[model samples]
Target: MEVAYRIHLTAILSVTCFLLKQGLPFRGNDESSNSLNKGNFLELLDWYSLRNEEVWKTVNQNAPGNNQLTSPKIQKELANACAMEITRVIVDDIGDNYFSLMVDEARDASIKQQMRVVL
Candidate 1:
């Protein structure tokens, strides 16, 4: 509930998402309950927090709550936010650049035509 704690949690969540996008494997759903104790990201964060005492006072103090960023709903929200952020960045980058898009039409086993776009 402290401002500092909120900021700390945000930073941790951001870093976790960044690593996740980079193809790193985080503990799956089954391990979410024990993430703080056994998860790699939290383990490393805990190790680093020891030296940076001012940034985070304690591991358990600002740790991710049960339904905070780890819950299924919250995870979907974060994924959507991340996707939108990526789309914005890509659109901005393409504004001044020339890019080619390809569209393909194919028939599926159900005899339905499907269109796919690649950029």
Candidate 2:
């Protein structure tokens, strides 16, 4: 059971990384099972399961309902974790070295003001 759970998480993480790298949206307007398009994340997982038997068996119907790990909150947590890891790597690489920082403010597509920082 533990191994299966790990496999399931690995699959989810892989799909999450792929979507993040592509800068794609994770959720759709309608994400029900009956919905034709269940968003990029779920759709990619389905596509991934088709190519991997272990993943297919360890997720969705095969896994326990409580351990599905398919919630939106779980997805956000994974993304945040990835971002933190990236920041850690950057900091480590710049350790004890002078680095330039840049900051800017802009509005997004939704007209929401946002700040960007680079180091």
Candidate 3:
């Protein structure tokens, strides 16, 4: 059971990272099971499971409802965790070194003003 849980988590995390890397939105307008497109994250997971038996069993069938780790909150937490790890790596690589920071203001697809920071 423990191994199965780990596999399930790994599969979800892989999909989450892929979406994050692509700068894609995680949720769709309708995410019901019967919906044609159940959002990028869920749709990706389903697509992945079709090619991996262990992931398919662990995620789609065997995982407990409470611990499926597919909630919106879980997705946010996973992305946050990935971001923190990336920041840690960057910081470690620049340890004891001076680095220049750049900031820029921009608008996203929704025309929302945002700040971009680079280290």
Candidate 4:
């Protein structure tokens, strides 16, 4: 049984290698292997951390576009899609009340693009 299994495996491998050697591109070479992986998922800046007050203030000052409690364009874009709201306490802001930010996760009206809002 084991001998038969090895024979079958060797046959498949030989066929594959033969096809690849014939320039069929069935096997991955060095460059092909390097380009196959898409890489890791990126951590977004908007929600990674609210840890430092300076960082929070910098984002608010530079991009007031993200300063509001919600993204109107986002809400409108998600007018027909399904979504949810996420709230988190941020110690990254320099102010009283320790005001927390409201973050919303919603998709475009067609459920294409998902967006977030923070206040």
| Leading candidate by TM-score | 3
Tens-digit lDDT track for model 3 on 20-118?
998889988898889999899999999999999999999989998899888889989999999999999999999999999999999999999988888
Error (Å) of candidate 3 at residue 83 is 0.5
In model 2, the runs with Cα more than 4 Å from the true position are 103-118
lDDT of 2 by residue, 11-101 (tens): 9999999999988889988999899999999999999999998999998657988887788999999999999998899999999999999
Every candidate's lDDT: 0.61, 0.91, 0.93, 0.35
After superposition, the stretches of candidate 4 with alpha carbons farther than 4 Å from their true spots are 1-33, 40-92
Total backbone collisions, model 4: 1
Residue range 24-78, candidate 1, lDDT tens digits: 5444434444554545454545555666765455344555555234444554566
Best by lDDT: 3
> What TM-score does candidate 4 get on C-alpha atoms?
0.23
Tell me each candidate's TM-score. Answer: 0.52, 0.85, 0.87, 0.23
RMSD of each: 7.4, 3.0, 2.5, 25.8
Arranged by lDDT, best first: 3, 2, 1, 4
- On a 0 to 100 scale, what is the lDDT of residue 69 in model 1? 43
Candidate 3: C-alpha RMSD to true structure equals 2.5
